[model samples]
Target: MNPIQQFVRWEAEKPEAIFLQQPLAGVWKKWTYRQAGQEIRSMATALAERGLPPRSRVGILSKNCAHWIMADLAIWMAGHISVPLYPTFTGNTIAQILEHSETKILFVGKLDTWEDQKAGIPTGVACIGFSTYLKTPFPAWEDLVTTHPPLKEFASWTADELATLKYTSGTTGNPKGVMLNFGAFQFVMKEGLNAIDVKPGDNNRLFSYLPLSHVAERSLVEMTALYSASTIYFSESLETFGANLAEAQPTIFLAVPRIWAKFREKILEAMPQPKLDKLLKIPLVNLLVKRAIKKKLGLAKCKWVISGAAPVAPELLRWFQKLDIIIRDTYGMTENLAFSHINLNKVKIGTVGHVWPGIQWRLSEQGELQMKHPGLMMGYYKDEALTNTVLTNDGYLKTGDKGEVDREGFFTITGRIKDQFKTDKGKFVDPTPIEMQLLQNPDIDQACVVGMGIPQPIALINLSAAGKSKSKDAIRDSIAQTLEHVNPSLESYEKLEAAVIMQRDWTVENGMLTPSMKLKRNELEKANLEKYPVWYKMKTAVVWE
Candidate 1:
């Protein structure tokens, strides 16, 4: 069933059960299943009255908020396509997506920085104010809800009906709209619920901090809540994220590697590494240490903790073992509605686990990962050529990722299709395998291997917050030792000459990192390309760049 129908079922099954808890005005606001259904129906009626044709593209731009979810369901309930626009997107990007998708009605919801992003809305496009920050000459959200009653009939969707258009984070090029049908979206929801063992009225609590624009969060937090009647707690802001998480004590916690590293660093900051190491070695004291760590991170009740969007360091996973948390890894993309492999029983640290059921998988002659999605995208909206390059003629979708299956069915992502580089010595190298080794160091938060025209590959390293405070000598020593150990396993072309420690973070605001938490390698290289010469001149194994 579609998410809206699922919501209707949940409302009927348990009307009074808490469906969503949204923190606002320094207070926790709530919505029961029945109340949420009412809001969704009201908004759907309002949109339908606006005379939008069936399958009309409508956009929602905001951070994670209750209105965003309501607006999304309403759009679906109104027989329209919900297009989620990232709040972190530039004005230019917002304009490009809205114009290209033929979206005219944009619902502006709970955004912290609307002033900077509002200019992107084209003159022809209209706006609906759905947030406290949306103070402009626009129709109020409450007006629509109060004036329009619930639509008499909810539009039922078939398997092939267009559901939503997902815009990619554009790591390599312009963001392409990923066209997903109701079949693909519902398939993800059903398979994902099965994978997590979520049943109706299961009491699986979720913390929503990741952007809903991304499919992972949309499914895990929003769609899962509808499918399983799970309660969701929203994070207020960056400053209150910790407190909100602590309040929620989520059952299933999924975090990006960047946030995971930050949590580790913050824990280490309060309790020094030396002290933590010493405390964990003590027999009974280790239990208290683990409890304390989990308590601090609000993961004490986390039955399943997952890391995705990038390769998680094995060292980080091992570090969590001292605290008794086994982080599972997952692999998927927007094109497939983010439904693919999920590490369940057998947790592989470095490898993304077995192929998801019902999804046929194979490797090309070039070792690129390919899968026959049960309900994959029809194609990239308005970009058939681009879609053809990724989706095969035989129903298998080309993942553009290089990987090999193990003796078991598990797959380990080795590198990207365009990730290989040629050295001055004329040998081609894929840095992903080498970078994964370097990232195992607890001191390095992120590592990118780049050296297209240089003699040897240069490792661009971003120090963890804890690593930044350490003396340069110690940091350099740690990396130097790591490199010395890693080079033997790598080919000559893949060996790093030096590690260039970045002084600044690679963030989404700077366009070095995408909203989905994937690194923009090409953008990062261009932004820091000049620093390569400066770092090359430094005759040291590790130098601050």
Candidate 2:
């Protein structure tokens, strides 16, 4: 069944059970299943009354909140396709996506940069803003809900009917909309639950903080919660994320690599790694220390802690494993509904575990991983030519990631085929592995290895919060030590000549990071291409840019 149907079933099964918990002004607000259903139905009626054509594209521009999910449901119930825009998108990007998707109505809610983004909304398109988050000039959601009655005749969707347009975080060019059907959602939800073996129950709790615009959060958190009849808690802001997560104590938790790094830094700040190591060596103290650490991180009750969106360092995973927190690394993309391979019970340290059932995968001559799955997107929206380039004639989705499969079928993504660059010496450098190594150093928060025309590759790095707190000499020494440790393991050409500390952090607002926290390599290169030569020629092992 589709997610809306699942929601309907739960609303009928347990009307009073809390389905969503949203925080505003440090106060927690709740929505029972019945209450949530009423709001969604009212909004659907409002949309239907607008006289839009069937399957019209409706956009949701907001951070993760209860209303974001409700808006998505309302769009579906109104016989419209949901188009989610990243809350971090700039005005230009917002305009591009809205125009490209032909969004009929936009739901503006809970945004920090709405002022900067409002100019992108076309005058012709109508808007409805969440009253709690923003006081927009447009019609308020509360007003619409109060004026419109619950939609008596909800739109029914076939399995193959279009559901949503999930736009990719554009690393190279304009973001392309990935067209997903109701069947894709159903397939992933069923197979994902089966793989994780998490049962549907009221006790299942989920903390939604990640960008629900992304497929990983949409599929795993939003859809999973709907499918399982679980309660979802929303973070109020970045400042309250820790407290909110701790309170929720979700049964299933997922975070990107950057978040995991921040968590590690937080832990190490309280108790230095050296001291923590000494304490953990004690048999009696180890369990207590691990429990305390997990509790502080709000993952004490997590049945499955997953790390995805980008490749995580094995060293980072190993560090967490010391505290008895085993992070399962997963691999997937927007095209596949983020359902491909996941490390479940028996996780290989560096590998994203075996492929899920019903997925067929093979390697191309270029070592690119290709897979055919039921959860694959219908295609990129209104871009059939580009879609044809990725989806093979025989139906396999070209993953664009180069990977290796071990004897046991565990998959390790080596690098993105498109991300490789050639040096002046004509040697190809795969930056992913080198970047992964650099990230192992607690001092470095983000690293990008770049040398398109230089003799040897050099690393551009931003210091972690811990690293920033250290003296310049101390940070340099740490970076020098990391380079010394990582270079010998690489081929001579692949070895980084020097590490250049960035002047500023790479953030989504700056266009250096995707909303998912993956590095925008092309953007980084563009901003620092000319400096590559100067950085490479620096006499010192570490250069502060």
Candidate 3:
């Protein structure tokens, strides 16, 4: 059954059961299945009254919230296609997507940057804001729901019908709208749940904080909750994220690599790594230490702790494993709804893991990974020519990633084919591996290896909070040690000439990072390209920007 049908079944079977929990101020406001169903139905009815054409594109611009999911369901119930925009998108991007998708109406919910983003909503398109978030000039959701009766008859869709347009994060260029159908959701939800062994139960708790526009969070958290009849908890704000997570103690958790690193930094701040290691060596003390740490991170009850969106450092994975927190690494893309590969019970430290069921994969001559699956997107919206470049005639999606498979069928993403840069020495350098090595240093938060026309590659790094707190001499020593350790393992052409410490951090607000926290390599290069030659010629192994 599709997610909408499954949601309806749960609403009928367990009307009083709590399905969503949203935190306001310090307290959590909850919605039972029946209450949520009523809101969805009422909103659906209100949408139908707007005289929009059939299958109209409706936009959702909000962070993860109960209203966001309700709005999506309401759009689907009203026989419209849902288009989700990342909460962190800039005004220009937001306007571009709304105009490109030809969105009829947009549901604006909780956002930290609403003031700047509001201008992006085109004048012709109507908007409705969630009562709890912003007080916009447009109509409010509460008013609409109170005025309209619940939609008695929900819209039914065929498996092949288009459901939602999930736009890409746009690391390299303008974001493309991925056309996902009901069948794609059905395939991924069914196979994905079975693969992860998730059982339907109200007791199963999930935390939804990542951008739901991203395929990983949409499929894993939102769709998984609907299929499994799980209770989902929403984070209040960034300031209270830790407390909210500890309160929820979700059974399933998903985070990108950067988040995992931040979590590590937080733990280390409370208890130094040396002391942690010393305590873990004790027999009974180790168990208590592990339990306490897990409880603090709100993963004490997490059955499946997953890391995706970008390649996680194996060093970080091994560090967590020592505390009995085994974080599974997953690999996939927006085009496939993130149904490519995942580490199940047995995990290979560096590799993403075995290929997921019903996925066929092969490597191109240039080492680009290609995969064909039933869950693949219909194609990019309004850009058939661009879509044809990625989706081959043979039905395989050119992943734009270079990867290798081990004998046991485990997969390791080597680098992005587009990210490879040629040096002045006439050698192509893959920056991903070198950047991954740079990340092994706890002092480094973000790393980008760029050479371009330089004689040799030089790494540009942003210091972590811990690194920033330390003395410059100490930070330099630590980074030098890491380079010393990593350089020996690299080929002569790929060896780094120096490490340049960036004066500023790369953040989503700065446009150096995508909303998913992956580096916008192209943007990073554009900002720092002119400094490469000077940095490469530095006498010191580590150069301060």
Per-candidate TM-scores read 0.97, 0.98, 0.99
Task: Supply the TM-score for candidate 2.
Answer: 0.98
Per-residue error (Å), model 1, residue 505: 1.4
lDDT of 3 at 139: 90
Clashing pairs in 2: none
Q: Over the stretch 229-293, how does candidate 2's per-residue lDDT look in tens digits?
A: 89889999999999888888898899998899989888888999789989999998999999998
Q: Relative to the unseen true structure, what is the Cα RMSD of model 3?
A: 1.0
lDDT of model 2, residue 534: 90
Model 1 root-mean-square deviation: 1.5
If the candidates were sorted by their lDDT against the true structure, best first, what order would they fall in? 3, 2, 1
Question: For residues 13-91, what per-residue lDDT tens digits would candidate 1 score against the true structure?
Answer: 8999998898876698999988888888988888888887788999999888888888888898898998999999999
Once fitted onto the true fold, the runs of candidate 2 whose alpha carbons sit more than 4 angstroms away are none
> lDDT for every model?
0.85, 0.91, 0.92
lDDT of 2: 0.91
For candidate 3, which ten residues in a row score worst on lDDT?
A: 195-204
Worst 10 residues of 1 by lDDT: 131-140
Error of 2 at 44 (Å): 0.7
